[model samples]
Target chain A: MNAIIRSTARCLRAGAAAVYLPVRAGARVWSASPPRRLLCAAADLQKDLGAMVKKDKVVVFMKGTPAQPMCGFSNAVVQILRMHGVDQYAAYNVLDDGELREGVKVFSNWPTIPQVYFSGEFVGGCDILLQMHQNGDLVEELKKLGIHSALLNAEKESK
Target chain B: MAETADHIRDKLIEELAAVHVDVEDTSPNRCAASFKVLVVSSQFEGKPLLQRHRMVNTCLAEELKEIHALEQKTLTPEQWEKQKSQ
Candidate 1:
């Protein structure tokens, strides 16, 4: 039995009865009669969202607008990309959709934001982006797309 | 695939007499899968960010395990009002 007890009318579907498992707090979540089916379904949703991120060559899901990012991290990505001169990328703001905002997690298998997906692959977030930019790897990656990064010159003053 | 963000939201609604709360699932791109949360409570006036986040984390610890990211935007009703004013 699952130790921690809480109750709500859970929907396996909309207003449908699903397995009622005993989730004991200390015990394994589902040792007996697993909620595997429901979990798989949920996993599927997360998977789908993950797929969408990779669906584009470069997708930038951020806050506010790309022109004026609301968060520091978002701002950093915008700044770095501008420096890179890689002008074409998609930006989706989670702020607009409460469901997409909260439910996007299951899709990406990731947990943080300013999530950038590139070449239909999981590109790391802000820190990774900065690291890549510093190493010239980010520029090289963009050049693979036939876009030469102007960031090389931008780094001149800093260096 | 874990618990729905709504499940977390429901718990908050049950626990707090919340007029406004928002939960965002941010698992698509970072490590330690997380949910970006914005909660407006009359309960959180003088509390700092750490304390406010801790409250939500504690309330949803089980879900937190499944959930790797918790981006919280916690504000008091007064604070929220101030944002609106601005």
Candidate 2:
């Protein structure tokens, strides 16, 4: 049943892509002369992205791992989540998997990397996270996930 | 090839009824691969940040195929007015 639902979702996504992004639909972004690795790593990326998103309450498909992020944008997101008292989230390094990297963009229907998901729901990337943090929405969202932000709690207690 | 910043700017103004739109190419060497966009529109008044980004993303779905990266700051007309003053 789960597999059936997943395939149906994939079909719907493909349909939407054709209708929405007709120019780039069904075409993988490859070099002028595509490398062997790029062509060969065409794994089932939709399944991989889905598994990763469902793997944890919070998941970040970023350029590098949390300890050492490759990009400034990814690093910024990691730091913000840390400041919010989050330390346990799944992080996938897209740099390691070409297929995963391209698949992720398609899966999220988002152009950038360092995408964040909360409880299987797609959240926005760096800018959105920053805005949520600034407006105190991140704290509330974390609370709903049963993850408490120590910094937020401290601020509350001081008031 | 992706559309130019001017094209994106004009499209956003037309589609989103944007009051202010700034699309800057942020890639190295001034390439059009990446962009930073700030859009102010009355349409975003009641939407959350995620939805606002989604709206912008959807608006530029075709352009996004060639534009490798995009960082967006979406704001409402009232918020944009406040930002301008400050």
Candidate 3:
């Protein structure tokens, strides 16, 4: 498991490096900012994130994968999605990439992990998701995305 | 010194002008690394959920560095009253 995690981390880093190289090279030439390198790196990460969130209808950046969340908060997020029958979403394990873990916080301007995105829009963390779930806002939000939540079906079946 | 629930409560009350703040230390050993908080303030009025959370995050930026998990429920005073009545 450790080996697999390590390899995955390596691949992610390599992928980030591939994205970073071109930006760094381009910035080296004519970038006027005094902190040119830092700015370029931040911009590159943001660009990557901008694409990543939109790549799926739902995206979750959490402490662990949906199948096995490492933290209780992350577990709660996984559970909530599962309860809504939202199975086919992008889940990024922040534990694998320190840079991604930190970068996402800055990207979303959120301070915690287990950040949820719907249709590339920033949803709140576990607390907000729980609130939405309780208040029935999640069902409406899911419907907007054309997803018929399982809970809604279940409610109908029960009645 | 490690942060206590009262410390967080005081900070939120002060920084956000919170009318009601409840901070519970949920760490297994009372280590102060994890917390669950409910904050009610007029500052959260007219703000979306994410923005309200961001306000609390920014208010506790330094404390969050030492904390592990933070669960927040932010509401405007009116919302808080509604919830309480319910």
Candidate 4:
């Protein structure tokens, strides 16, 4: 099953324009050439996205809703995002979308959900995100974007 | 008297009159409960994957609050026969 999940995992290939989509199970990782078009306007989620992206600087879409994560992988991503003090991002439950979950891989050209988009740019999955946090790079990247890297609390100001 | 995978399985067998069904418990994961399923039924013929899975999900909807992940490998009886060739 673990093999089933990873072979299905979509991620940006190192120095590759097309994403590697796993097909015929783990035995094959098909190279799917992604269309080179930035058609955010064509995005199915475009209708409410004006409200969606503006509502949250960071957004996560995954298999289960945040309150109850259906998989261990999903929960791991949520934990890492929280650890970065980024509790404000919106989360869309991908179990709601057959297209978005699969399409998101094509949309972002990266497979896997519990996916993170910062200011609408694909920021990678749990493994990549956690790696960034450990390397002290995620904080700087978010700061550069003027996005809060972690959940900022009010009480800390008085201290 | 209480709920078990076997209890759910029996209910599904009765409800769908299915030809085959397999259920496995995977509750060790931190969320609620999880079950791995492979079901074959004549009723599921011509259905999409999601719909087939949803049928199983809906059949056990009330029971699903206890089940978080349902890894399904649903098939029509015909599809199962085709898979048997592999």
Pairwise lDDT winner, candidates 2 and 4: 2
Question: Once model 4 is optimally superposed onto the true structure by TM-score, how far is the C-alpha of residue A20 displaced, in angstroms?
Answer: 27
- Residues B1-86, candidate 1: write the lDDT tens digits: 57676877888767755568887777765333567767888777686544565566667767766764566666788878888899
Error of 3 at A149 (Å): 0.7
Evaluated on CA atoms against the true complex, candidate 2 attains a DockQ of: 0.59
lDDT of 4 by residue, A40-132 (tens): 223533433334434445767776766677767678777776676555556667676454555565565443455677776666665556656
Model 2: residues >4 Å from true position, as ranges?
A1-44, A153-159
What's the alpha carbon RMSD for model 2?
11.3
- Candidate 3 residue-wise lDDT at A90: 73
Model 1 has a DockQ score of 0.08
Error of 2 at A73 (Å): 1.0
Tell me how each candidate scores on DockQ against the true complex: 0.08, 0.59, 0.69, 0.02
Candidate 4 docking class: incorrect
Residue-level lDDT of model 2, residues B1-86, one tens digit each, is 75799999999999999999999999997889889999999999899888899899999998988887889999998998888899
**How well is each residue in A1-159 modelled by candidate 1, as lDDT tens digits?**
342221122223312533222212122232333222243244544554555555545667776667768777778887888778765666667776443455564455444566777776666566567767876788887877567788767678779
Candidate 3 clash figure, as a count: 0
DockQ-based ranking:
3, 2, 1, 4
Residue pair clashes in candidate 3: none
CAPRI band for model 2:
medium
Order the candidates by TM-score, highest first: 3, 2, 1, 4
- Two-way TM-score contest, 1 vs 3, winner: 3
Give the alpha-carbon lDDT of every model: 0.62, 0.78, 0.82, 0.60
